[model samples]
Target chain A: MANVRIERLHKEFRGAGGIVHALADLTLDIADGEFISLVGPSGCGKTTALRIIAGLETPTSGRILFDGRDITRLEPRDRNIAMVFQSYALYPHMTVRQNLEYGLRKRGAPRDERARKVAAIAAMLRIEPMLDRRPLQLSGGQRQRVALGRALIRDPEVFLLDEPLSNLDAKLRVHMRAELAALHQKVRTTMVYVTHDQLEAMTLSDRIVVMNHGVMQQVGRPEEIYSRPANRFVAEFIGTPSMNMIEGQVRTEAGRPLFTGPGITVVLPRDAPQALPSSGRATLGIRPEHVSLVAPDAPGAIPARVTVSELAGPERFHFVAVEGGSIIVRTPAATVLHPGETVALGFDPDRLHLFDGTGEDAPALR
Target chain B: MPPRNAARLYPLVLLLLAFVAFPLYWMASTSLKPQTEVFRVPPTFVPETWTLRHYVELFWLTDFGLLFVNSLKVCLVSTGLALVVGSLGAYALARFRVRGKEAYGRLVLLAYMFPGALLVIPLLLLFRQLGLTNSHLGLSLAYLTFAVPFVMWVMRDFFASVPVDLEEAALIDGASRLGALWDVVLPQAVPGLIATGIFAFLFAWNEYLFALILISDESLRTLPPGMMRFVSTTDTNWGLIMAASTLATLPMALAFGLIQRYLVTGLGAGGVKG
Candidate 1:
């Protein structure tokens, strides 16, 4: 196992749309035996960063170090990194056994050794019956399992997975997610997984790296990314229903600082880390589940008219129109609230996130 | 309903099939015809008297054996050259970031569009100056000027259809870049190689104009030009001509037969993306 370190990586692509700045000056350190997930939207450079580390793509400017050895100029074969592509990329011509043994044969391993390794991996993945079958003959789930097996059989220093489970059905993806977790535990090799699904990153990664448009927004534990996002993007991106955004300003009213926007005003605690800049531009973010629904007469409540109510089994999402944009508050489905009903939305002071300024001066929150 | 549609389309299909088969049937029949039955006002659909005297005389008495050997040598060498060079060229264009790739692809096909007839005179002179006239090597070189681009373009389009990820996987699996191509990319490209090889072979095998101009030595002439030797200024022997034409077509038919199964499968290669 080897710890991978990316130092000041930059990559640019030239296409018909002109130059695409796919990755900025990004740096990351992945410890040995660690599972790191790079999560972002499409074209967000998460895959680019993974490819650079795999040596499939070279960075325009940077060095990739494996266990403190500079491997930036190494070919993929020399890098000792096994990648499981999103499409599985199983050789259509080869049988399952052949696919698993291809790497071993390339390295001129003994035939007996190759077979023994393939047999062991097949038994582990429970795909022994499928050794004779072609990739096309296998089902999607089976192909994915074989793809995983192919990577595992190599026992490379690092494994790079590019959305390996994305093509499977929902249930299979979940099942394989657990399988992958178990496999990682057993092998304990360094892995860097790239996905656009934040949930996958949250569940599978020791550290989740959130990126957008070629820049890393935050790097932290899953729960930390959820509870303490680094910026507006992470706060909005890491949650399912998405965190609520209320564009407001910090105003000094009667010698006390208050967050005021539209029809809502709340006094800021003295210990708040985020403060309004001289431009008086600031935004407050709160998760949907974090916002409490209270009676209209409740203290510290902001009045809002309910626009819609959605049910997800026992949980309810109440969409309320307030401020510049609406915020959805999560509540129990048993709660009785009709559209257009006047209610109050409350915020947890400790759970709130605030950002100051815009553009380059925008504060990346803690 | 199926019977009704078949009945409606049957006559047209039969007519088209017969129209296409007639010329080939006539050529085969004429090859078997005895000299007395060669010109009996109208052509015979089948030879009343079947014989192989023309084949025997042509092979033994005429320069047929030398010509046939020369054609085989030239066609095989040129096809081999084209496939080897073309596949490498195609791989580069398909996988690498070549500057002005679109223009380069179009420029490759432009060599195909430029008429072979236009190049004959200039090529003949160049061959003469280079002491390549009257040689199979000169003729093969001329064929490559047309064949390489055709093979390259077709194989480029074919190589592009193969997923780059497969090659990358091979590369990551202890294979060098060329090793990956040899193990993964080339194995998947058999159908394309066969198709391109057949085309290049046929182009060299059946080509007449450049062969006639470049080869002046009777011993060095390929099948097409050598067969023309039967056509004297006074009279043309239709029987020998037909027999030689049939002989010349045998290699192409064998090539198609060898690759027929792969043709259907290769054309349907987008089936398993994973």
Candidate 2:
């Protein structure tokens, strides 16, 4: 196992739109045997960062150190990295056994030894039945299993997965996520999985690196990131139902600070942080689950008109119109609220976040 | 689905098939007929009196067998060299980030489109300087001008269509760039190589202008130019020429029959090459 350290790596590609920055001064540290995920939307540079770690892409600047050794310019084969591509990338001409045995053969392992290793990995992946079948003969899930088996046979220090489960169907994707996590636990190798799905990052990785537009937004544990997002992007990007934001300003009212939006005003809690930005404009971020629905007469509750109500399994979501902006409020299935009905939105002061207008500005949880 | 409509289309389809097969039928029929019946008026579809005299003459009375062997040697050498060198060039075009790559690809194709007449004179001069005139090597080299480019263009497109992910996967699996190319990339290009190889071979086989200019010795003549010797200012032996043409087309059918299986089983399942 190896600890991977990336220091200020940058990657630029010249496209029709001129220079497109795929990775912008990115730095990350992955501890030995730890699972880390680079999570972002498309064009967010997360895949670029993963490819750079695998030595498949050259960084414009900075270095990648593995086990305290500089390997920035090393060839991918010399780096001892095994990667699973999003497409599985199985050799169609080879059978499942041959595909898995490819790396061992390249490393000059004996034929019998390679067969033993292939048999073991095939049994582990439950692809023993497919050993003699070409990749074209396998189903999508079977192909992914063979791809994983191919990487596992390498026994590399660091394993890189580039959205390996993204091509699977929804049910198989979830199943493979758990299988991959289990495989990581068994092997205890440093792994970096890249995905656009927030849930996959949250459930699979020990730490998640949230990125946007070639910039790192936050890097923390799943619950830590979910509860305390660093900026407005993270707050809105995470969670099942995205967090709601109200574009407003903070003003001092009667020697106390208050957040004022279109037609609503919220008095800031007295214990609000002193480093809260003094900017005139601030965004009030509220998580759907944190916004409790209450009677219209509740104190400190903003008046809202229920716009849409949706029931998904055991939970219910209510979209409420308040201050000329729509906000989603998640609640228990037992709660009944209909459109055109007026209700009060109870803000959880401990969970509420306030961000300055700019993306570079950090958020403060009040 | 309808019997009447099928019957109505039969005559048109048969007419088109006959239009296609008549030349082949005429060549065979004339090759089997005696010389006295070759130019008979009111052209008979079938030979009333058949004899193998022209075939006997094609094999024994002349050095045409040697000419046929020479054509095979030239075509096979040119095709083999084009596939090897052209595939390497195509792999470079598909994989590497060469400067002016688009312009280079376009220029390679432009070179292929040039007719043999345009390059044969220049080739003659170059061949004389290299002491390659009237040599099989010189003709094969001349054929490569277009053969290599045609094969390169076709192979480049096929290589590009193969996903680059396969090579990347191979590289990360402890294979070098060259190893990945040979192992993961080239195997997937079998179908394309077969297709392009036949075209390159045909280009050399049917090259009349260059063969006429490059080879003067009777033994070095290819089928196309060697058959031309039958139609002279004096008497034209249509029967022997037809027999020779019929004999020359068999090698192509043999070559196709040998490799048609790969064309059927090729493509899909492997990671895309590009």
Candidate 3:
């Protein structure tokens, strides 16, 4: 397996109206045997970047290097990468055995070698009984397995999966995600996976590349991306139920600094910046799990009116309105709170994030 | 009790059956009638006396056998050429981003929509200039204008229904574009190919206007125009005419019967959204 390096890659499509810059100056380094996921909202060019790596698409600028050799102009076959599509694009007319052997046959492998590889892959995928069946006869999950088997038989330098598990049902998707993780561990190939599902990105990837608006936001371990987001967009986009963002002004209070919004005020951590931006506007971000509900008389708590309470299994999510904005708090399912009731919302100072007045400005407080 | 949906459909089904089966039954019965009873004051629903004399006379006196062979040869050649050229063009239009591809696709459909009669005169002159008049090869070439457009249009839609991902997967497997189409796409398109072939064959087989204008040699005449020669100035042998018509329709009937299953499957698959 070889490591792949993408340097300042850009892709633009010229449509009837104007040029759509699908990918802009994307540079990433995928180490050998690394499982990296490109995750983002739809139309963010994550798939386009993967396609460019696979040689299915050409970049408008920049270069891609595989194992220290430039391969930007190579054909997909010459690139030696195997890609699994979201649709599990199996040849409908060919039996499973033929499908698995397609790549080997195309490369002019010996008949015995092709047969041996087909049998081995079929056994690994547990598709021996299905070797004679056409794709139309297989279930969605089965087709996906066959699609994976087809790619595996190629023994390529990198495994590129474009939302391979997205077509399966929920339970099957979870099963296949774990199976894919195990498969990657077994094969130890340099794999680049693309998906819009954050859970998949978090669970399966060794490193996750988060993107937005055709721009890479951050590439880091899942926890780093979730806990220490590079910007406000990354913070809001990576978490379930999303992080609560409150617009406020950062100002000095007494000896320490504090954040002041329309109807609430909270002191920042002691290490935080005392001098704020001249505009005196900032935004505070806190995850739902970081917030808590406490007794009205609890110390260092903000008083707020609870707007909605939803029971999600063993956890409860409380939407509390403190000032001009609302924050969600995950509490014990037994912690009962009614709508319109005044409650104390407590959170750790360390978990609070403060950004500059203009959201686009540098983050003023961490 | 509520009225059943089947009960509601009974009269419409009966009407459709009558509309379809009546002409076929009339044709068959007329073919079996003796010449004297064929035009009786009240047309006989069934012949009073069955005879094979008209069938015997057609093979013995007319050039029916030669015409049958000629029609078969021309239809097969034209259909084969149309399927090959049209399928390649369709695949290209469906898969490639050639310059003016959309325009080319539109032009093929427009050609198919234009009436064949309008081109017959120009085509006749062109055939003469090219030394193709009265030749089977010329007739086959003339049929291409109609058949190729038809095959191309239907096959274009057929190829479009096939997922591009399958071909891409083949490409990743080291198959060239042509190899992938031949090995993967064409197999899945078997029913479509058959349907388009049948359409081209029937178009050439049943065509009368072009054959009449282009071919004057009795040996090169197809079944339709050759049957017209049986009509005399004073008397028309109705039995012989019906026999020849029946004989001419047999091949079409047998062909449709053999491929009806594939035709249905093809139409269903080709028309469905990918």
User: Candidate 2 lDDT, tens digit per residue, A1-366?
Assistant: 899999999999987699999889888889999999999889999999989989999988989999999999999989998999999999999988889999999999999999899989999999998899999999999999899899989789999999999899999999998999999989999999899999999999899999998988899999999988998888888888998888888877787778888887888787765555666778888899989977677777889999899999899999999875899999889998988999988888777788876454455544
Give candidate 3 regions above 4 Å deviation.
Answer: A253-255, A273-278, A294-299, A358-366, B1-3, B98-103
Query: What residue pairs are clashing in model 1?
Result: none
* lDDT for predicted candidate 1 compared with the true structure: 0.87
**How does candidate 3 score on lDDT?**
0.88
**Best candidate, TM-score:** 2
TM-score of chain A of 1: 0.96
Candidate 2 structure lDDT? 0.88
Give one digit per residue, the lDDT tens place, for model 2 in B1-274.
Answer: 6999999999999999999978988998999998888888987778999899999998888678888899999999999999999999999998898889999999999999988788989989989999888899889988999999988888887888888899999998889988998999888888888878887998899889999998888878888998888888989999999999888877886877887776454333212433
| lDDT of every model, 2 decimals | 0.87, 0.88, 0.88
Error of 3 at A57 (Å): 2.3
Query: What are the per-residue Cα lDDT tens digits for candidate 1 across A248-286?
Result: 777777766678888888776666754456677788788
Tens digits of per-residue lDDT for model 3 on A152-267? 99899989999998889999999999999999999999999999999999999999998877889889999998888877777888888898888878888788887887776788
Ranking by TM-score: 2, 1, 3
The deviation in Å at residue A165 for candidate 3 is 1.6
Docking class of 3: medium
DockQ of each: 0.80, 0.87, 0.71
Q: Where does candidate 2 stray beyond 4 Å?
A: A358-366, B1-15, B257-274
